[model samples]
Target: MTHVLILGANGQIARYAIDLLLNETDAQLTLYLRNANRLSNLQSDRVSIREGDVLDLATLKEAMESQDVVYANLSGDMEGQAKNIVKNMEKTGLKRLIFINAFGIYDEIPGEFGKWNQRVIGQYLPPYRKAADIIEDSDLDYTIVRPPWLTNEDEIDYEITQKAGPFIGTVVSRKSVASLVVKMVESPGLHVRRNLGINKPNTNGDRPAFME
Candidate 1:
């Protein structure tokens, strides 16, 4: 069975992805997180939990060994952690990665909404941008999924855009991002070394609501 290691396993999107992978695939999953206590509720024979910070290279190396793919859904200190992950992945000879990043990292959004996004989330974009650059430069086959503001809604219907194309909506469901991650892992050929923006397609002319 394919083995996958997930960083930031306690995150909302990561948890949902874990659930989807558990249900839909027979892969062995290793969940790496700083707080193991938060994941106490998730018990499975195919899942193994590792308590460690992503910034710690030794720990990351230990967790990454023998894993076929690594899915990083990390926040806070993401750039440094991503660099460490890349370095270790090279050392371990594991060449597949799927990164969860934010939509505004590319500065590709247009109009007033784009300006508004820059005003609000702009300060945080640089780190993710740097992280994306690191992944792009690495030898590992990588897929970066950039989602707009996240929501708790349980739906998997969303559209994706490669490169600088706009997704046309403000927010997407966390479950949808999770589903996408699982699909990416199952089929790595679909988005290797490509960055994609994802959002729920607008059904009507009404303004999209922010995901809570």
Candidate 2:
């Protein structure tokens, strides 16, 4: 059975992905986050919770041991986190990494929506871009997911674009991103070394519909 380690396990998308993984696959899961009490209600024979910050390299390495995949759902100081993840994963000899990141990190979004996104969130893109660069430079088999404005809708609907093209759409459901993550977890080779842009199709506008 695959053993998956989830960093920032309390994140909204990681929570959704955790549910999907438990329901759809038999993978053993290690949910790593800063606080255990937040997820104390989560109990399963297939799950374990590790409480520590990603910046804590000793704990991060301990969690990576014997794991088959690492899925990171994180924010704030992502560049530092990426460096630690890469350092430890390389030491542990683990290869697959599915990292969640925000859209526009690559200046890939086009048109008015892109401009709007920059105006609103541009201040936050530098660290994310540096994180992406760090992961890309590593030898690990990694998939960097860049999701556009996210929503809490119950629906699962999304499309994907590679880093080579302009990103499409303005928003995507959290459930949709989780579904994609579960898919990759189930099939490790799905998008290795690729930067993926995910969004709901045809929702393009000056901003996310929810913001309008």
Candidate 3:
């Protein structure tokens, strides 16, 4: 069975991914978080929860051992945390990763949509880009997922863009993002070495439809 470590298990996207993996695949999972007690309700034989921070080398190193894949859904000083993950994974001989980054990390969004996003989240873009750079520079086989504004929806449909493409679509469902992550974990070859942008299909606007 594929062994997976989810580094930010308490995140909404990570939570959805945990449920999907448990229900749809035979993979075993270890959910690592600062406060894993928040996920006590999901405790099961196939799922193990550990309380830890990604920045703690010893704790993270122990968590990475023996895992086939590392899926990181994280925020805050992203570049630094990503640095820690890269170092630990290198130490553990783990190479596969699924990193959740935000849209505009490449400043690829265009037109009014681009301007809107900048106005909304200009402050967060730099650190996110720095984190993406760290992952890109590493030897690890990684899929960097750059998702647009996320929503809570049941729909699983999304369109994808490679890094250089003008990032399209406004808001994609968090479930769609998680679904893709689980698909990658199951297949293990879905989007290796690619930086992907995900968005709900048929969506286009200055801002997410939900905002209006």
Candidate 4:
């Protein structure tokens, strides 16, 4: 069985991914978060919860043990968190990582929606971009997932754009992103060293529908 370590396990996207991973795959999971109690209900033979902050290098390294993949669904102090994850993973000799980030980090979103995105969340981009840069500079096999504005819709309708191209669409469902994450977990070789932009097809506009 594959052993996957999930950082920021309590994140909304991580929650969706966890449910799908449990239902669709036989991967053993180590759910690492600041509060273990948040995921206590998920404890089972294949699921283990670890309570510790990502900035805690010693604890983070310990959690990386015997794992095949590391999926990070995190926010706040992203640069610091990314550095710690890279450092810990290097020390522990774990190579595969799946990291979540925002779409406009590369200014890849085009047209009015792109400008609108910057106006709305421009302040948060520096740290997220720094985090992405950290992962990109690392030797660990990594996939940087750039998801557009997210929604809670109960569907998995989405598409992918490579980093070199303009990003498409305005929003994608959380379930869509989760499905993509699970697909990456199931096939470790998939999208290695790639920065993916995920969005719902044909939803392009000046802003996300919800925002409009």
Candidate 5:
């Protein structure tokens, strides 16, 4: 079975993705987080939890070994942590990475509303953008997913666009982002070495056509 390592496993999006992967896919999963207590209930035969900070290169490298893919859904000092992840992955020869980023990082958000979004949420964008830059520059095969405003709504319908492409909407459910991450892990050919933006499409109150 394919082995996948998830960083920030206790995070909301990461938790949802882990649930999806555990139930839907056959991939062996290892969850790496700063606190294992938060993930006490997630233990399973196929799931293993490791307590360690991503900023600690030794811990990250140890966790990344023999892992086919790494999904990073970390918050806080994301840029520095992401840089460390890349360095450790490179050291370990773990080439595949899927990084969760936020929209507006490219300044490609459209309309006056986009401007307001930049003013309000802009401060946090730089670190993610810097993280994306690190991944893009690395030799690793990476997929950087830039999602729009996140909601805890229980829906998994959304759309995705490539870098420099027009963003679809302003908000998306965390469920959708989680679904996309699992999908990418299951099928790496779809989005390797690309930075994509994801959002819910404007449609009727029905299941949307595509996600990622």
Candidate 6:
């Protein structure tokens, strides 16, 4: 059975990943969040709950132990969190990582969507970019996922760009993102050391639908 540790368990995308792992694979999960009580419905034999911050190295180190895969779905001060995860993983010799950062981190988005995203998230991308830098520099088997504006749809229709062209499409469903994460965990070497941009197939627009 695959053993996975999910950081930022409280986030919506992470929750989706947790459910997919528990329901779809013979996977044992250690769910980490700042508040364990928030995970009221996820208790099960295959799941263990841990409450702590990823920035807390001691706690993060402990969580990384015996974990075959590490999936981080976090936001805010992500550079610090990435540093913490990378440092501890190096110490523990844990290699596989699936990290979720947003689409604009690489300045890859094009057209009005790119402009809108930049105007909207100008303040958040610096640290996220730094986070990507840290992970890319590390020797870990890492896939840096840059998903477009997230939607709540359940459909898995998505497209992938491997850092080769302009990031197409405007929004991607969280379910689609979870599917990719699950795929990577179940098959460890699927996209090792690659940066992937995930988006909906035909949803490309001037901006996210919500704003237009």
Q: Per-residue lDDT for 71-187 in model 5, tens only? A: 999889888998899899889888889999888888877776577678778977888888888889999999999887778889999988889776667778899999999998899
Number of clashes recorded per candidate = 0, 0, 0, 0, 0, 0
Candidate 2 local lDDT, 112-192, one digit each (tens): 999999999999899999999999999999999999888999999999999999999999999999999999999999999
How many steric clashes does model 4 contain? Answer: 0
lDDT of 3 by residue, 1-212 (tens): 99999998999999889888989999999999999779888868998888999989999999998999999999887988999999999998999999999998787998898998898898779999999999999999999999999998988989889997789899899999999999999999889999999999888987888887
What lDDT tens digits, residue by residue, belong to model 6 across residues 136-182?
99999999999988899988888899887889999899999999999
Model 2 residue 195 lDDT?
94
TM-score for model 4?
A: 0.99
In what order do the candidates fall by lDDT, top score first? Answer: 2, 4, 3, 6, 1, 5
Q: For candidate 6, give the lDDT of residue 13.
A: 93
lDDT of 2: 0.96
What's each prediction's TM-score?
Answer: 0.95, 0.99, 0.98, 0.99, 0.93, 0.97
For model 1, residues 86-117, the per-residue Cα lDDT tens digits are: 99999999998999988778788877677877
Candidate closer to the true structure by TM-score (higher is better), 1 or 4: 4
- State the TM-score for model 3: 0.98
Give me candidate 5's TM-score against the actual structure. Answer: 0.93
User: Candidate 3 deviates by what RMSD?
Assistant: 0.7
lDDT tens string, model 4, 1-212? Answer: 89999999999999999999999999999999999989877767999999999999999999999999999999999999999999999999999999999889989989999899999998889999999999999999999999988999999999999999999999999999999999999999999999999999999899999877
The candidate, 1 or 6, that scores higher on TM-score is: 6
Give the runs in model 1 whose Cα sits over 4 Å from its true position.
203-208
